[model samples]
Every structure is written in C-alpha cells, then in structure tokens.
Target: MPGLSRRGERMPPSPIRKLVPLAEDAKRRGVRVHHVNIGQPDIESPEEFLEALRDPGTRIVPYGHSAGLWEYRDGLVEYYARFGIRVASDEIVVTTGGSEAIIFAFLALADPGDEVIVPEPFYTNYNGFAVEAGVTLVPVTCRIEDGFRLPPLSALETRITSRTRAILICNPNNPTGYVYSREELEALRDLVVERDLFLLSDEVYREFVFDGAAAHSVLHLEGIGDRGVLLDSISKRYSVCGARLGCLVTRNRDLLSAALRLGQARLCAPTLEQKAARRALDASPEYLEQVLDEYRARRDAVFEELAGIEGVLAVKPKGAFYTVVRLPVEDAEAFARWLLTDFQVEGETVMIAPAAGFYATPGLGRDEVRIAFVRKVPEMRRAMRILKLGLQAYRGAPARAGDRAGP
Candidate 1:
C-alpha cells in the first residue's frame, strides 16, 4: 500500500463534524438529537432565490465567465454599495463559496511557508484551508472573559515576523460571535499598513449582528482598499447555504488577477446557484431585518438558558450565531460524546462542537465547546434544557456512583 502525502497526514478533522458515528448510532436507537453543533440555519431562503431556481430562464446551464456571470457580479456591486463599500464589478471574483474565497486569498497573498495572523478560535475550516494552501495560521489569543474581543493591537503585533504576509479577521466572528468595532478596525488598518500586510475580512455574518451593535467592515476603512480583501457569501445572509456561491472583493489588481487565474483553474462557480444568488441579492432589506429578528430571539433564548446552568460560563454573543462556552467538565470532547452515547432526556440529546480544534496552539480550549443557536427559539430552548440536564447528570454521575459504593 502506498503511503499518503504529508499534507494529507497533517490535515486536522473538523471539530464540528467529528462525532457523527455516535450521533448516527443514537438516532438509529430512536433517540431525537438537537444539533447545536454546526451553523445550518432553519430559516427559509428568500422567495426571489426560490423563484429564480423555479424558473432558471436558461436551457443549457453552460459555464459562466471564470470570474462570474457579468449580471451576478453587477448585482454584487449594488449589494456591496448598499453597505457603503464601493467597488467596481471587475474587481470581484466569484468563487465556489466563502471557503474558496479564503483559499484564493491564501494562494494569492502568501507563499507556502508564509504566516497569516488570526484571532484565536476562528472559524474552524480555516485550519483546513491553511493546510490546503500550505500557509500557517498564527493565532493571537482572545479571552472569553473579555467576550472574545480582538486583543490590543500591540498584542497582535508581537506575533508578527519577517514571514508574516497578512492578517485575517471574521467580522461578527464565528465560534465566539465577537463583532469588531470601528476602533478595532481602524487599529487593524493601521497595523496592516505599518506591517505591509494584506488584510482579509470574512464578513459573511454581516447582517446577523444583535443588540444594535454595528459590524464595521475592513473595506470601510479609509485608504485601505489596496491592502484589503473582502471575503463574502450569500449562504448565511440569505439562508441559502446550498447555493455554494460567494465572492472575493478587492481593489488590488494584482491580487484580483491571481484570484481570477485560480478561479479559471476551477472553471467557474455553479451557474444555477449564481442565478439564484443574483435574485437573492435583490431581496428586500425587510427580508434580512426579519431574519435578524429571528436570530436575535434565538440568541436570547439560548443565552438565558446557559446562564441558568451552574458552572457554565459564556458571555452573551454580540453577533453571529455561535458562542464558545466554558464547561464544568474537564474534557469538553468527552462530555459532548457522552451526550450522544450515554445520556438522553426523554429520548432527546444535543450535539455540540468541541472547541479544541478551533485553536492552533496546543492544549487550548480543552474545556470549551461552541454552540450554534441556529434553530428556532422554541427548539433552541429545548436543546438548551437538554444541555443543562446533561451537564448536571454528567457532573453528578461519578459522585453518585462513589457514594453508592461507600458504607
């Protein structure tokens, strides 16, 4: 048998999906499972998006321009402009998804051994993308005690080295749901300029901010265009995760050209999805406003329930749909696995993502788990109830067994 390549060996499994066999086994036993593990929303996609698919207007469904369909890119120009981000349609390169947009940035901006500094506990798939691009992710730790806000710019600067090529951030971040403030964005803009590094902003959760908190885009920073790359997707924005369409927005012609070549290598993004996404871009602002309301309700429901669980510590998430929670258990992965394997409340259990794989540094996040409150409010309440009960049972089981064995 042939040995696999080093890259394949180095790849890390997704913490979000690693416990599938246990969950499947539970379901096979006729147990109900509440998924708070991944960010698959239960919201309906906008009517316009559905309508476009119902009437695709085209027969052949041929490959679009490698950059994207002209109409789709044009629609994106209008979409970004609404957010006060000005860009030419030519400057956008549509990719397979935000996942590919990230890979494009890594390939275009950094050499194989180069480093990209990111806040710790970032989107987990970033690890996979880093392996694929052969670039390193250098993490600057952020504490849940501080609600996972970006650390002081000085703290970030300490991580910079001669091989550092860029700084990446997720506005309204994943796993922690920490939204970057305007001051933080300005600080990062200055740092990137002083360090001569590219700034990649993943703004996929732009509209999911809660509590009237604002999410400032790196593209909104003055004079940062040449140094900024905006990675965006319609997946979360329109509840269209199946669409598999996203774009890389930048004003750097050199980077844009490189991304185009990569896009060409892949041929093009999905044509039917692009057409549907173009219609999605035109969805009324009210559509997003209503969606935001739903997420806000879900957030409140989950946060309130978490607060009731003794030994559970989590700051209320300000944006996005997830929160990294510190659990009472010594090993969160074990606790999460036990929920699927041994425990159930009225034949229902919850699945969660352990937080260790979201970090690059060893031994971090061993007692933490990330929960995506993407279900509706009632469902989230039920999941949180199950989570609370699971924690109680898990913590008391050993003590109870020991007491029974004693005189």
Candidate 2:
C-alpha cells in the first residue's frame, strides 16, 4: 500500500481523550473513573432545545442554505445583539461547529505556509485545524505565573513577519481559563491595527466568566471594526456538544464571502440543529444564571482542593471551567497514564488532560495538566482528593526513581 498521506500522519491526537483505552481498561477491571478530562457539562440543556429537536416542524430534512437557515441566522443576529455585538445575518456563515469555524477562518484569512500568531497553550484542536488548513501558527508564550494574560504588546509585535496574516485569541481561554481584560484587548486592538492583520477572536465561553469580570468582545473594540472575526458556538454555551452548531461572524464582507464559499464546499451545517439553535434562543435567561452559579461553585471547589495538595501549583481560573495545574510529577503525561493504569483510591481514579498537547511550542506544559471542573462541586472535590492521593502514591512508587533523582 502507498504510505498514508503526510497530513494524516502529522495530525495530532486529542490529548483530552488519548487515554480512553486505559480508562476503559480501568472500568473493565471494576474501577470508577472520575472524568475531569474533557469539558462536557453535566448540566441539562435547556428544555426548549430538546422540544425543538423533537418537533423539527419539517416533513423532510433538507439541505440548509450554505450560509445557514435564514430564520436561524435571524435569531443569531438578535443573540449577538444581546452581547452588544451588532452583526447582520448576511455577515454570518454558520459552521458545523466552532472547530469548523476556526478551520474556515484559517482558510479564508491565510494561505498555506502563511503564518498566524497565537498565544501558546491555546486550544489544542487549533493544532489540527492549522494542519488541515495548511497554515502555520506562530506562538507567543503566555506564562501561567501571570495568570495567563496576554504578553506585552512588544512581545506580540516582535513575532509579526511579512507572512503573518492574523492574531488569533480565545477569550476565557481553554486549558487556562484566563479571561482577557479590556485593557489587554485594547492593546491587541492596537497591535492588530498597527500590523494590518485580522483579529480572530474565539468567544465561545463568554457566558462563563467568574469573579464579576466581563468578557470584552472584539466587536466592542474601537479600532478593530473591519479586522475582527468572531468565532462562536452554542456547544459549550447551551451544553449541546452533539448538536455541532456554530458560526463565524465578521463585519468584513470579503472574509464573509470567502467563508461562505468554504461553507458551500461543505454544503451546509446540520439543518435540524439550526432549528434547535433557533429555539435555544428562547431559553430562559435564568438557565444560564443557574448554570453559571453551578460552574462558579465547581471552580471554587477545584481551587480550594488544589490549595491543599502539596507541591501542586495552580492559579484560580477567572473564567471558563478549566485550569492548568502544574503537578509535582516529572512527566505529567506518564502520571496521567499511571492514574488510569495503576493508581486508584477506594476503587476511584480521576482522568485529566496532560497539558503538553495544549501548547504549540515544545516542552512548555510537560509538567502541567489541564483539569475541567465539569462535575458538581462535591464530585469535583472528590475528584481532586483522588488526584491528591494519586500524586502521593505516584511519587512514592518505585517506578519514579528518576523523579526522585534531581537533574
């Protein structure tokens, strides 16, 4: 057989789920796994979403408009308006998911071999998207000691080369849960404007900000009018991961045209899900209020528990439901695997994402793991307890002779 394509070979596996086989084996051997690896919410989706799916109101499922269902886009316009992001339905190209939107943005904004600057320890799937789009992602490192804030504008500016096409950011960032403040955003606005590059902002976790902090949308930035592209989704917002509904919104008609062509190439997003997304707009505001309250409690539980774990370095996440924790282990991935393969406390073990995969630059997150506080507060506390115990046991294990020996 001819060798598998290089692109297929180069694709990075999802670190969030790479340990599934071991977890499955653990389960087969009668161990309970407390999954804090992925960000799948345990909360119930809104009732209106289920109702819309149950009664799709169409006799036959047909291909939607390449841009999206008109009514659905109409609903999205109002939804964006609620965030003070004024966008017309025509400027939006609904995608299969935020993943698709990112890929499409990369396709529309840059050519193969062209570069886009992104902070290190960004969303891991961006690596796959960059691979698929054939674009190069340049990393500007953000330190966890600084609460994962955007680095100095001078540092970001230093990375810009002639081939640099855009600066991509995830507000309420994944893996770190650091919400970018408005001043930081303004500095980005100034940088992108000065460099004449696109500002691709992924604001999927806008509703999950904690500590009374506000998430500033790129649309709200004064100088970023035409240069801004907003990639958003209902998956995390409404707990509809399987629905796969998301959209790319921008004021740049040229970018929208490019994205729409890509959308046409893919045909269209799922039709029924668009209807469900429309109905999701009708969800009571209290739904998110309650959801936010629960996540806040979970976040507190995670931080409070981590504080008691000796040698674990963690900063309390300001937004989103995740935190990147520096573990005491020499190899976080090996420790993560050992948790599933060898360690357990009273028949229970916790699964976490080794944070190395979340970084584009090599060897940055090797000592860290990303934990999602998706479960309820008590469950999160218990999972942390299991993790703490697991750490102690892993350290004392004879297999970690190298860990005990200093460099």
Candidate 3:
C-alpha cells in the first residue's frame, strides 16, 4: 500500500473543531451544548445576498474569470473607497476565501523555507497555510499582558533575519480580538519599509471593532505602499460565510500579477458566490448597526460573566467576537474535551477552542482557550455560567487570585 503524502500527514487538525466529535457525542446523550468555539456569526445574511442567489435570470453556472468577475472586482473598489483605501479593479484578485488569499500571499511573496514573522496566538489556519506553502512561520509572541498588542519594534526586529520575507497581521485579531490602532500600524509601517519586506494585512473584521475603537488599515500607513497586500472578506461583514468570497488587494503590480496567475491555476472562485458577494455592497448601514448592537451586548455579557469567575483570567476583547481566556487547568485542551465528555451544568456544556493550536511555538497557549461570543446575549450569559461551574468541577485547578490583565 502507498503511504499518504507528507503534506497530508503534517497538516494539523483544526483545534477549533477537533473536539466537535466529542461535542456531538455529548449532544447524542441529550447534553445541550453552547458552542463558543468557531467564529461563525449567528447574524443573518443580508436579504440582498439571498436575492442574488435566487435570481431566475441566471442561466448557466460556469467558471468565472480567473481574476473574478469585473463587476464584482469593481464592487470591491467601491467597498474600499468607503474606508478611504484606494485600489483599482485590476489590482484585486478575488480568491475562494480569506484562506485562499493567505496561501496566495505566501506563495507570491516568499520561497519555500523563507520565513514570515507573525504574532503569537494568531489565526490557527495560518499554520496550515504556511505548511502547505513550505514557508516558515516565525513567531513574535505578544503577551496578553499587553492587550495582545504587537511586541516592541525592537523585539519584532529580532525575529527578522536574512530568511525573513514578510510580516503578517490580522487587525481585530482572531482569538484575542485586539484591534491594532493607527499608531501601532504606523510603527509596523516604518519597520517593514525599513526592512523592505511584505506586509500581509488581514482586515476581514474591520467593522467589528468595539468600545468605540477604530481599526486602522495597513493601507492607511504612509510608507510601504507597494508592499502591502490587503486581504478583505465579505464573510463576517455580511454574515456570508458560505459565500466563500474574498479578494487580495495590492498596489504592487508584480505581486498582483503573481496572485492572478495563482488564481488561474485554481481556475476561479465560485461564480454564483461572487455574484452574491456583490450584493454585499448593497447592504445598508442599518444592517451592520443592528448586528453590532447585538454583538456588543454579547461581548458585555461574556466579559462580565467571565470576570465573576474565581480563577479564570480573561482579557476584554476590543474587536472581533473572540477573546483568549486563561483557564486554571494544567492542560486547556484536556479540560475543553472534558467539558464535552464529562462535565455538564444542568445538561448543558460549552465548547471552546484550545488556544495552543493558534501558536506555532510549542508549550505556549496550553493554559488558554479562545471563546467566541457569537451567540445572543442571554445564550452567552448561560454559556458563561456553564463555564464558571465547569471550571469549579474540573479538578478545581487553582489560579492566583487577582491575576486579571488587559484594559
């Protein structure tokens, strides 16, 4: 028998979903599960989006242009204009998803074994993407103590070597929900420009900022104009995850050309989804306003509830819908599985992502889990209560008193 390829074997299972089978088993036994694991928002997709999908005017479902439909690309231009970022349709290469954009960016910018520096507790899928591209992901650990802000530029500089090709970041970062400010981005701008490296910016959660915090796009940076690649998604913005539509934007014609070639290699993104994603542009302000309000309430519910728990260390997330939580258990992954298989508060248990997979460096994030406050406020409150009670029962691993961090 032929053995499986190394890529298949090396690819790590998603920590965000690895415990889903256990969760299913719990559900089979009649345990109601509050899923706070993945960042699938419960907000409804825009009506216009559904309308686009159901249009009887459509005749054939054919492959789209390799660069995506010109109309859809133009729509993306208008979408960016609202944010004061300018890019031409030719500079945008629509991808299958933000996930595809990451892979394309890595392939376009760096060679195999070349390094890209990313902050720790980053989006876990980046590890898979790096492995697929054969690019080395170097970690620059950003402590929860610093609100998950970028470590000092000096510390970041230490990670850059001859093999370093780019620096990647996610604004309104996943897991931590730490929104990078304009000042923080500008500091990154100076460093990347000085080092003459690429800046791959994932701004999928641009509008999900909380507490009146503004998310600064890397495009807003003064320098590194040609080196910036903005990865934008319509998923969270319009609650269109199934749409699987996103685009890679860059002012550099070379990188743009390379990305388009890669797009051709994969054929094209789904034609129908691209059409539906165009409908996202038609979504009015009120839609996001209502969605934001609901998420704000959920965020407050989660923070307030977690704060009351005795030993749990939770940082208040400022953007996105997730926060990295430090649990008292020696192994957060084990505790997460135990919650699904063992503990239940009145027949309800919560599923959370063990944070260790979000880091490339081993032994980090073992004590932490990432919780998504994507449910409604009352559901979130109940989920938090389950977490509080579950922690009390799971060996009662003691944490230091008054160990809270973050603003």
Q: TM-score of every model?
A: 0.97, 0.98, 0.96
Q: Estimate, for each residue in 267-355, the C-alpha lDDT of model 1 and write its tens digit.
A: 99999999899888888899999999888899999989998988889988889999999988777888899899999999999999999
Off by over 4 Å in 2: 399-402, 405-407
- By lDDT, the best candidate is 2
Give me the runs in candidate 1 sitting further than 4 Å from their true place: 399-407
Ranking by lDDT: 2, 1, 3
CA lDDT for candidate 2: 0.91
What's model 3's lDDT at 335? 80
Q: Give one digit per residue, the lDDT tens place, for model 2 in 1-407.
A: 89978789988888888999999999999999999999999989999999999998889999999999999999999998998988899989999999999999999889889999999898999999999988899999989888788888888899999999999999989979999989999888988888899999999999999988999999889879889999999999999999998999999999999999999998999999999999989899999999999999999988899999989889898888899999988789988998999988899999999999999888899889999989999999999999999888887777663355121
Cα lDDT of all candidates, in order?
A: 0.91, 0.91, 0.88
Root-mean-square deviation of every model: 2.6, 1.3, 3.3
Q: Which ten residues in a row have the lowest lDDT in candidate 2?
A: 398-407
Candidate 1 structure, TM-score to reference: 0.97
Clashing residue pairs in candidate 3 (N, C-alpha, C atoms within 3 angstroms): none
